[model samples]
Target: MHRVRVLPKYLSKRLDRWRSTTFSENREWFSHLASHGQHPRAMFISCCDSRVDPVAMFEGEPGDFFLVRNVANLVPPCAVNRELHGTSAAIEYAVLVLGVSHIVIMGHSGCGGVAACYDKCEGVNAEWEKNTSFISQWIEVLAPGYERIKDMDGDRSERLSAFEKEGVKVSLENLLTFPFVRAAVEEGRLVLHGVWADIGSGALFAYDGSTESFVEV
Candidate 1:
């Protein structure tokens, strides 16, 4: 058998410090969460960018939000095929089992996944469009958003910024494609939100469905 890798010293030291301080200070709260189980108020679907931390951004505690992270924070339309759907499965559990009241899909500025999708849709990056890359297929969900903004009059950076926000809107729309999610939303049991983050400036913009635009939050 192949030898297993050991944890790096830096990471091990950080864990030890967390266990000694943060964990020790919050032992009772952690125990309560373990015994009572999670009942998150919101389900946050966000990008897998290292700079974006849902808990830190929201100042949330354990069991506060059911967080799901994926490329570009894209949510594909509901498909019932036998293929494994980890994100969809997590969404299902969050909505049906946990009964989360809100679902937020937050995309970020300078998203590599969104950039790749833009490149793929524009027929510019043959490498990203290759069949072998899982990422190439995953961000295909953003194709519709690309179609909407591809012809807009803007520089590359501006278009990309719009595309990132558009990606959030696309995910929100896809979330509604799930019948259960739609039903819950219609029945007033759940609400959906789309947000975009400017990582450099620490700015957040929330999609206003009424205006069909993202406004600063």
Candidate 2:
């Protein structure tokens, strides 16, 4: 027995508004999705930041993408163990079951998770090291990204921007650690993309493997 509460009033009203407007307008589309099932072509891995909405950013519809969001948009290395892995499970389903052709890891500017990792590594934040702090451990996944940018000659903001993009690259590498993901890539069945978004400026960048850098897109 757990305490479950009703939807908040504001959200409830929003749901009603959606039902009357968006849902009503797209009833057939929704019905078709329900009947035929979703067949999204790409799987989008993105941050849980409210400002970063993949659907709106990509101008995509409901069944266009299988989306997985987490703090810092981090992907941990695949490991065999008894512990539950939510993100890994989502990746497995997206690749094997959905058979998506592309997987995108999108990082964003002003990410609090990335900022926390930056502070943690710089010894500016000790709260993340506490035994009871789950966030502390989760953001540790970005430590490798921090390492890549720590010594770079730049101001705080510049270093943070570099670190943010590095986090996307780190996730791309970790994505390959999954044998299924690697096999799919090698077999030409799937593609992996790294992207970063600047929230304030609405600018996007994509990693260009040829240049080994992120180029504005």
Candidate 3:
């Protein structure tokens, strides 16, 4: 029989601390939430990067945001398919069921997924990203954004940063294609936001639809 590995002692200790302290301090709130269910105000879609902490970025409490983290923070246009679609399913639940008023697509600087998409679209032939790999296929969703900036007159890093923000634009546009999302927004019940973070400096940029550019927030 294959034995299941237990949580590491050190990591388990962290949970113990939370249970003993954090959970204890918020026991009443926890009990209420457990009974009433989550009613988050926002749905935050972000890149699955270790440095980009959605909670920390927003100083959020538990159940404050319906969070979905995926590669490059890319949102594919709404599709009905038999194949398992974790990202799309989460968005549907958040928008249609949870009734979240805000959808924030958060991307960040120095994102590895963005870099992979840039390289793949640029035909760099990276060995780590075989075309058949799951990551390769997932990152392909950002290919259009990469293609948009792959030839722009800038250094590789600058172009990569542009690509990251472009991914946010793509996601925001894609979110509207969902009928539920569009209905909610049109009824003045929902708002969409695009955010990019400079991971190195801990700075955030918000998309300004006015200028079609990101500005420091």
Best-fitting candidate, scored by TM-score: 1
In order of appearance, the predictions have TM-scores of: 0.98, 0.97, 0.95
Candidate 2 per-residue C-alpha lDDT over 1-217 given as tens digits, one digit per residue, 9 for 90 to 100 = 4688888999999999999999999999999999999999999999999999988999999799999999999999999799888999999999999999999999999999999999999998889878788888898888988888999998999998999999999999999999999999999999999999999999999998788899999
Q: Which stretches of candidate 1 lie over 4 Å from their true place?
A: 1-3
Candidate 3 CA-lDDT value: 0.89
**Ten residues in a row with the worst lDDT in model 3?**
123-132
* Candidate with best lDDT: 2
Instruction: Provide the overall lDDT of each model, using Cα atoms, as 2-decimal numbers.
Output: 0.92, 0.94, 0.89
lDDT of each residue in 1-217, candidate 1, tens digit only: 4787899899999999999999999999999999999989999999899999888999998889999899899889899999888899999999899999999998899999999999998889998877899999899989899988999998999999999988988888889999999999999999999888899999999999999988899
**Higher-TM-score candidate of 1 and 2:** 1
- Evaluated against the true structure, the overall lDDT of model 2 is 0.94
TM-score of 1: 0.98
In the range 7-68, model 3's lDDT, one tens digit per residue, is 99999999999999989999999999999999999989998899899898789998799999
